[model samples]
Each structure stands twice: as C-alpha cells, then as structure tokens.
Target: MQIVDHGRVSVGCHVANGWTVVEATGEMDIFTSPMIRAAIIKLLQDGHRHFVLDLCPTAFLDSMGLGMIVAITKRIQAHQGSLRIACADQRLLHIFSLGGLRKSYAFHDSVDEATREVPRHNGLGRWPRPRD
Candidate 1:
C-alpha cells in the first residue's frame, strides 16, 4: 500500500478483488485534494482500470474536493475505466446531493459493497473503435 500524507489529509491505495481502492483520511479540501488526484492518476498509469474510492474516513470536504472528484471521474471514464465511491457519511452524502452529483456516480455504504460487482461497460475496452 502506498500512502501520501500532507498534515491535514492522508491518501492511501491498495488493490482488492481486481479493483484498486483509494482511501482518504481527514479533510479533503484545497490543500489535500491534490494528493487524491495524484494517487488515482498514478494508479491509472500503472494499468488499473477499476477503482473504488473509499471516502468513509473523510471528515470534511470542500468544493475543490468535489471538483477534483468530478475531474477524476471524467478522466477515468475517458480511459474506459470505472470508479465507485464508498461513502457512508450523511454530511458528505448531503453535500454530494446538493452538488447534484448523486446520480452521476455509483455510491455504496462500504468498500466491500462497492467492490462486490463489476461496473458495467460499453463492451469496448480501452479503445472504442476497432482497427481496420
């Protein structure tokens, strides 16, 4: 497992059941969102296609953090990958709802629940078009 700590926040990642689980501890704000983004980007570069973002331990989140997740989601989708978010915190859940992102992501109550099923894809791998 690799972890990056920056005083206010700490990020860690590990592979589980064919999925990469990235967990964040502490507040995810302007000061710490980068660590989460960097970790996921590195994992994607490392050939990971499926991911479970375990934000259960996160105590706080800000607009920048939400934006970072949105950007990361787009990047992962563009790469033909999948991302599931595990968050059981009511406050955070309310924030997501208020941000109008509740329907945009697949959210679960726990990491185990999130990793139990494979995300549905369009039957295309990394490349959408076939070679001629």
Candidate 2:
C-alpha cells in the first residue's frame, strides 16, 4: 500500500477481490478532504471501477468531507461503477444517518465484509446480484 500522508490526513490504497480499497486515516475536514478526493479521482482515472472506502481509522469527518464522499459516489455511479463505505465508528454512522445518507451507501463493519459483497453491475447500470 502506497500511503500518502498529507499533514493531518493520510490515504492509502490497494486492490482486493477486484475492488480498490482506499484506507483513509486522521481527520477528514475542509482542509483534508481534498487529499482523499484526489486519491480516489486518480484511481478512477486509472480505470478502477469498483471501490471500498475504508474509513474506520478516520477520527473526524466534517460537512466538507461528507460532501466529498457524496461527490465521489456520484462520479463512480456515473461510470457504471460502485463505491461502498467500510466504517465501524458509531459516531460517524450516526452522522451519516442524520445527513440522510444511510440509504445512499452500503456501510460495512469491516473492509473484509465490504469487499466480500462487490456488486456485479451490468452495462445497463443494474446490479444483477445486489450486494448486502
């Protein structure tokens, strides 16, 4: 994993089970969210269609960070790809719920669990085997 430490935030990535797992650590706020976004965008440019964003190690997530995530998800879906979030922090989960994003993403307890259920999306933008 090539991890890039951008001050208070660091991002690393690796491929597992045909999905690119992007692990983000440290605070994700207005100043640090861009680093995370850039990393994911670079992967997308490199033809990575499936992704698992592992945010378990993240200590903080502000509105900017949440917006960045939503934007990334939209971009992935536009490419007929998918993005799943692996986050176990209850506080973060609650934030997601409060932001009305619980239905917008597949949140997992771990990266293993998230990668195990990669959605098999067809060219028509439909998942033949819906992931749990």
Candidates in order, TM-scores: namely 0.88, 0.89
Clashing pairs in 1: none
lDDT of 1 by residue, 50-79 (tens): 888899999999889999998887778777
lDDT of 2 by residue, 11-128 (tens): 9999999889999999999998888888888888989888899999999988899989988877787778878889999999888878777766778899999888656672215432
**Over 4 Å off in model 1, which ranges?**
119-132
Index of the highest-TM-score prediction? 2
Question: What C-alpha root-mean-square deviation, in Å, does candidate 1 show against the real structure?
Answer: 5.6
Quantify all predictions' global Cα lDDT against the true fold: 0.81, 0.83
Q: Model 2: runs farther than 4 Å from truth? A: 122-132
Evaluate residue 103 in candidate 1 and report its C-alpha lDDT on the 0 to 100 scale. Answer: 64
Q: Provide the lDDT at 100 for model 1.
A: 80
Candidate 2 is scored at a TM of: 0.89
Model 2: weakest 10-residue lDDT segment is 122-131
RMSD of each: 5.6, 3.3
- Backbone clash numbers for all candidates listed: 0, 0
What TM value does model 1 have?
Answer: 0.88
